[model samples]
Target: MHDFLVDLLICPKCYGELDWQIEQRSLNHIEKGEARCQVCHTSYPVQDGIGYFLLPDSGREDLWQEVDSHLVQHLQQNPEIEKRLMGVPLETLSPADQFFRAMVHEEREEFELAEESQSVANSGIYTDAYLSCWQSQTKYLMDRLASNDKPLIDLASGRGYLVEKLAQNHDFPIVATDFSPKVMRRNRRWFEYLGISDRVSLLAFDATKMPFKDASLEIMTSNLGLPNIKGPSELLHELRRVLAGRFMSITHFYPVDDNQNRELLRQANLETMLVRDLASAAFEQSGLQVEFTNICLSLAEPTPVGVVLEGAGIDALPVAETNLEWCLLEAQQSSKAKH
Candidate 1:
């Protein structure tokens, strides 16, 4: 929404430069406006201080709006939760607490089910062992990330958990990009409420073809989002096009080569090598090198999905290489190399 963001934006349809048609403004941010492409003549809108660079055919807007309304009502019902989130910003609550509170407010029904399922799964040793591994890996990643001040774009930032954490802990500006208008609207409201809006901006766009120009961005991140993308290679290729530094992501990785893991993947209609191979190929195509890969989430017990499937007599559940830690990558043409 900032005036300077115009420099980084391009026509999603044709990747051409755009001319702004401002209808409203708030200080330095554009409250409402339209961006017309210089080449293709395509027009994208800026609403609620967030820019929408999505294509004409993008779905999920209405569903997400409904989700946002439910989330807001959920927050309103819980006085303690609302107070913690709206009060004192960073000093009032821990990042984990804030994250949990937000999750409860945003996905109360799902969170309750997950907790119940986790209780059932925690009776097994798998869950404990997984948590231990996940903790160690995440600690290392947070340590490294704490020292990084590079401008970052967190793609597929559902509900802005990482964005909230980063905005609270770091001094640099962060861009939270997603495909859902309602999600972005909620993100904007949450950031503003937390007093971190000054450090964050919400953007609505497709991951396969981001609005950012070639080599304009330093870092890109997608957590638990790679699996949802149908064509990750194309998304990676797009990441390579815009990222001048690196693309870091954390996603579920199944051990397809293992018999048990292979069976689990089969039940889910997934291939173990799908994300790994796609990311590797995409990194190579984008002229990026794989920097680090960590085990971010070690599943000590069955996941909610796994528990349900197992309860239904499906013995094979996804277990191996469950959640990867912050896998850091570096672009070959990076302008700013991290120390």
Candidate 2:
């Protein structure tokens, strides 16, 4: 982590000032170190330039990450499966199988080829309306970020496309945060490979237990990540507490009236983020002025199951067809709260 960012951070446990002891340094950054809270004495480590500020009794998990843990283990044990999938012509495979192949390539650290395969897979899954909405939001976000050079924190980044695009196009310092150490570590390597390693800082910490001082962060962002947090009432309040600027997010909400997917969202307890009114009210109650724009809707059908992998469930999406309403959620810290 950069030595300069230490002032922006606090002990997640006690919200106390930290005494940083640097063990290794390279140029302008601290490669390895320990941060000890002055009040509570909890120690958080910094490794490979990514600070670890996670709480042991954390209430959040990025379980909504696209890469499935089980399938990774499956591919690790079955080496021949990867070979078999790669040998097949991409032209003939089902889109779901192509997407699965792309993920396998990602697991193997062949990111360039994985990206190519992912594009091919997405063409089949996302309708033109969906693609247009995504492009619009991404452009909107980049345009918005162009005006500000402040340090920005992205919550539950999950190695998603949103942050990578930001790091490539924008000059500002960006912090990509998630609760998982393994994910952050892999992302550090990925950024290095992409030649934008200097553009981003990785911090592993729970959203509910922020390492930042209250209203200290100037800007924040997410790409369909907020909805995935386990319980967001506390998360939203914590988000409001830390962000003094706007939180710009690119997300899509499922049709609430679609009974086909009704039970599914309820079972997962995702009404707050998936239901428009509930999501807006949740953000408002947390002391933010919430608004959504760039609104559009598109027909979404069930993604084809993995035919090449013998239908072993490549990934999960809605099983029924529905209209997905895509929007850019922009929430600002309430002016009243500033006083």
Candidate 3:
């Protein structure tokens, strides 16, 4: 974690300021340390320059745990280059996608052992959608926000693509927060590998209960992560509580036209609508004004599941266009609460 960002962190349980104790440091990077909440006396560990301001358990256990375990094992074997990517095995892609693919590769065995076997399909979709969305808009969003001098936080940063980009291109302080330690660990390594660890800070914290004081953050962002969250309303409220400047996000929205698309939305707890409807509802709920909104077709091709349309032949499969809808929303503080 960066030395300056330590002042902005608070205890999620009591909302009190955190007192950080540094055990190891390299310039601005705190390689090993601990953060103790002054009010509640709860202590959170800082590992590999990333602070984990999260609960003992976030109740999420699955392929990620397996992936982290595997990575930890690999790191143990190659301690010399653990912080650097010199010894890590990754495929050819953007650094973020390479880390993601590495995680998926490491977790395959444990994924097969799971009772439901959803990880296989979910991981593929996740990789495709995130790569597509990032390639499509994340850099553009960062470019728009880069001119601002205020501190920026990337909420639910899946693989820290924006974080890396912003850190490399700008001098302003940047922080990346995610609920998964495994993902953040990869992010820390990536930063180290790219020689930008001093420019970025990583934290593991729940989105619903971020460890920041009210209005402490100037800008917040998330790319293709809001829909996976269970409660959009609560998240928006939390964003409003912590963000004093702007909140921008890129989400995958599907237009519920066909039965297959509708079913997909139902399973994901999503609704189909125009890009404006989604942006308006989100901004209204968060008490933020919609400053900008952009809609575009998804770059990933939809994989057909071979379901026949209602009016088609009995043996025919419905040829539906991809339900993937890519949307961008830029919102800022509003005086009046629309909801």
What lDDT does each candidate get? 0.63, 0.82, 0.65
List clash counts for every candidate, in order: 8, 1, 0
Rank by lDDT (best first): 2, 3, 1
Error of 1 at 259 (Å): 3.9
Model 3 local distance difference test score:
0.65
Show model 3 residue runs off by greater than 4 Å: 60-136, 256-258, 272-279, 303-320, 337-339
- The alpha-carbon lDDT assigned to residue 306 of candidate 2 equals 78
Measured by lDDT, the strongest candidate is 2
How many clashes would you count in candidate 2?
1
List TM-score per model, in order: 0.70, 0.92, 0.72
> Candidate 2: misplaced stretches above 4 Å?
59-69, 76-80
Per-residue lDDT, model 3, residue 167, is: 81
Whose lDDT is higher: candidate 1's or candidate 3's?
A: 3
Q: Which of candidates 2 and 3 is the stronger one according to TM-score?
A: 2
lDDT of 1 at 116: 38
- For model 1, the stretches where C-alpha displacement exceeds 4 angstroms are 62-104, 107-139, 146-149, 260-278, 294-297, 305-339
Give residue 58's error in model 2 in angstroms.
3.3
Task: Tell me which residue pairs clash in candidate 2.
Answer: 1-49
Q: Model 1, 278-320: lDDT tens per residue?
A: 4455566545566446544444223332221122222234554
TM-score sort, best first: 2, 3, 1
